[model samples]
Target: MLIIFIICILALNPIAATENSSDWKTQKVENVNFKLAPQYENGELVNSKYYTIKNMFIFSIRYIDSDSFLKSSYGDDASSEDTHYIKNKNIKGHNSSIIYQERNIDGVKYNTTYIYFPIKDEIYCISYNGSNITQDIEEMIKNTPKQTMSEKKFYSKLTHATVSYEYSQREENSYNDYYYRTPYQYNNQNKNQWGKYYLAYSLGRSSRYYY
Candidate 1:
């Protein structure tokens, strides 16, 4: 089964300072048939669950030949036909977003927020997800140091990465359980993620698609 091996980013709050929260702006755009969500603008917590503290941004783009776009924009081979981006049905619903690691592109930097659909060979569809690539960029948005978008560099670094595949093998048992592993390639070098985090891995079969 195709499962989304999500590296749950126990992400930290934005750390930079900004004064751009003049007011909250919420706009929804539909690209082709899918939707586009470009920024994180607000937050509200309900029933012990954070309704929308807006830690993520989302956008969807549909292409007749989705593979072509992924290859050109992200690399030589990409697909999004199988990619799924679930909506809350209601604006207040919570769902998952597919985001790859960040990277630099064409002298500009942006963290990628996209999901891919790799068909027989190339990608079939994709969605522009979110990016919080650097500490400075994150700080600027979260208004960590402060909380606004005014004086900061007006841009965030976005990375479009090659799709990745991961696999695991385990002994089958009557009862199902899970374990944890440290994240790969993330530099929390200067940050202290101490008692604030945990990881879980299932010892049985569980599949999920990220969109």
Candidate 2:
């Protein structure tokens, strides 16, 4: 009976591995390409690539045009007491700007980092929500190559249409839940209320995507 139970567990291990492997697919947004699993928020698919490591941290990547990058706000968070920006930092041969933010949500503190770098006409952003930056995350950043239209155009295809970039805002009275507001919303209503808590909230949430 012991040997039979052990064989049953071994047989099920491959099935679980296959299911997890099938969840990820190659996705390309604008000029950047990467592998991501389909993540949903409120039953809708999001517009970024994300991978969760050990169920503790989430690493996501997104890119937008230079025009959008300049127009959007990065710093200035009213909700978070600690927010810092380090500019012209070198990461894997790319000069990047890093945003380190900390927020207290429902008595829990969350730490998030955003690494921004320009690749040709677009600005690529890699974000991680965790206290410590692990070696695997560093490896992912180091291995992130410059993807262009002229390179491997036949093999890589754009998976989703580019949406106008907008900064995220945390929903009122919610833990780890956030909603994105367009540039027009900010301009017309709360332009001065732009913050990084939304970005932190969106990424810190369980398996949510962001642009």
Candidate 3:
């Protein structure tokens, strides 16, 4: 009788097959909606540029095919990292290794973290970097909901979804043509050297700096 009941339950709640990333289910958690972006190569998802949302945060998710590939991409950082800080955290019920690195870009110092974890047969690389870090961004990892098989489809869609963006605000500073000063720099000298300071702005918690 128990065996029969188990069989009935299995038949009723059949496992959902994995689908491509394009068809993955999207859900909103903590007022943020996460949708999969397709950009993969050789069965691995690799987005050259991050997807920025809300003008303050940026994120990227990549799929690693095998342990061999994971080592190839993260050989030095995973093992012989003598300078940066490395640690582990339980994320989404999985033990994820986190590595911190810092570098100066255009005179601005930016902090970054590389988070690596495995799910089933493949590994995931989730990373974020910015001039400032916040608790909300840190919570993003912990609060991510466990996805179903159908939701996993979004990750697979990245293989064919690597289309380039015509103009993304995230990459606005990269192009040289976008800069034009109004009212002239000479005229603004009398003005505050740091002009247009706002009275109020949101403050985010700072992450650990490399050095």
Top-lDDT candidate index: 2
Using TM-score as the yardstick, the better of models 1 and 2 is 2
Q: How far is candidate 1 from the true structure (C-alpha RMSD, Å)?
A: 25.0
As for lDDT, the candidate ahead, 1 or 2, is 2
Instruction: Write out the backbone clash pairs for model 3.
Output: 19-153, 20-153, 21-153, 21-154, 21-157, 38-158, 39-158, 40-158
TM-score ranking of the models? 2, 3, 1
Instruction: Residues 43-88, candidate 2: write the lDDT tens digits.
Output: 2124443323322114556564434343342323212347654444
Better of 2 and 3 by lDDT: 2
Clashes found in each candidate (C-alpha, N, C closer than 3 A):
32, 0, 8
What tens digits encode model 3's per-residue C-alpha lDDT throughout 115-187?
7554443355565664332343334444454433332442332212222121232355454333554456546
TM-score of candidate 1 relative to the true fold: 0.22
Q: What is the lDDT of residue 117 in candidate 1?
A: 28
Indicate whether candidate 1 or candidate 3 has the larger lDDT: 3
Better of 2 and 3 by TM-score: 2
lDDT of 1 by residue, 151-174 (tens): 111111012333321111122221
